[model samples]
Target: MWGGCWPAGPLRRSAFTRRLSVPISAPEALLTVRGLEAGYGKIGVLHGVDLHIAAGEVVTLLGPNGAGKTSLLRALSGLLPWSGGSARFGGLELRGVGPREAAQAGLVHVIEGHRVFTQISVTDNLLLAGYDLPRAERMARVEEALSFFPEIAAKRHEKGGALSGGQQQMLAVAQGLVRRPRLLMLDEPSAGLSPVLVDRVLNVVRELQARGTAVLLVEQLIEKALGAADRVYALAQGRIVLEAATSEADLPRRLERAYFGDDAVSPLEA
Candidate 1:
């Protein structure tokens, strides 16, 4: 389900696309979802969804609120039960994988709402995620993540609730990073941040990709998603309505229609 390298925007290139195209040297797809159907208590929010992400790629799922974006993230994280389809990570099927199992397999999901441990200090929040690793390795990752988010380390002893909204989001992402996940899933990462903070967070995402971590982002910020993702899958009414390389010339037009119906709404490409 991969192809040759194409320009990201008038001739930019992506290692992920180039690697996915090679049948022999290709790395196993980091994540694949086929006919995925999931919802809350049989409500059937997602219908026959299909998506894939290769190792070291950034794929964004963009849609309006209630379009089942959050549901899909929950299902992928094993928080919600999937009625049908298969989610496979590195050739291992996720039929019976719980959240713990998913994390163990290198898929770390960072949900929105900044669900950090409010009672714990910021440092403890990050350390908790790396508890499974040996002391040296965990400490090394801690240092690395802190470099990406020096604010957290500076406020390490502060309670989670004491931080600002942006700080909390940073902590959430930093926590996920400590896990050293192969596939990082973010749900509405920029949902409530200020414009500057949103940009900062996206920069952090780019850094993760530069370090070879695959990112699957669920974002309502249309422009941010397009700017950050190598490719995109747009969903409407619980189904995939559009899939395109982020670099396509008609991407903005198509995305507007998918996101705003027949209205003249336009998504600004950040």
Candidate 2:
């Protein structure tokens, strides 16, 4: 079923593809990073990475495995501390900010994998996301988030372990939505999901964009990622190699060259 959703053929354009003709300028960007670097003890992963995401824009980050995509997201969301450089979200400095502070500042990271607690009820899991809120506001936020995923809303009382893999993924995303973040960083939401379920998850990016929420997505599905984004950034060896508007022509060829270096042959020429 997963194979059918993402086949080795020409790319399938997503129904939610953006039609923007011009890229967002840096001055209006919602998130900005300059010369950012981070890694686990004694090892460096990201090297002088510079990137920006405009308000309400969907920007997809693509690269082969070990491209530091996950590391970049972790650094931005305060999961991994930045060792050098600087980052600013909504004009506030990000250094020394922790995960909870990042979320409270309207920058939420929905980490890869279906990470919900199996023993907890679906609604309870969402409630935990808003645990710091007042009683009434927390309940209201939970209801607002459930509105986006009727599949899980119908199973609100069920333990997270009882849901299928797809539903669990939805619940994880819903957990992020409970905060109503201004900028959501999704680290491969499509991982391990069937194509149908992948589409269901990507569709939420569209809904979020329509409501003026910006997203920085790191995904493995090239076609789907490009389809859902207004711009694309390719990271290789812990650095950004390519940045282009999704509407540009010959993107596959450009992406190939970016991934394999300038010497790579375009599919058309080959």
Highest-scoring model, TM-score: 2
Candidate 2: residue 128 lDDT (0-100)? 96
- Tens-place lDDT per residue, model 1, 1-270, is 101111122211221122121111225778878899988884889988878888999888876556788888888888989889998899679866799988988899998878899998987787788988888888888877888887777998999999998899999999899888899999877867888988888998899899899998987666777889888887665777677788888877765565444454355632
Candidate 1 structure lDDT: 0.78
**Model 2 segments more than 4 A misplaced:** 1-24, 262-270
Question: Which candidate achieves the best lDDT against the true structure?
Answer: 2
lDDT of each: 0.78, 0.84
Q: Estimate each model's TM-score.
A: 0.85, 0.89
Q: What is residue 204's positional error in candidate 1, in angstroms? A: 0.9
Screening candidate 2 with a backbone cut-off below 3 angstroms (N, C-alpha, C), the clashing residue pairs are: none
Question: lDDT tens string, model 2, 5-43?
Answer: 222222212211322123346558889989998989889
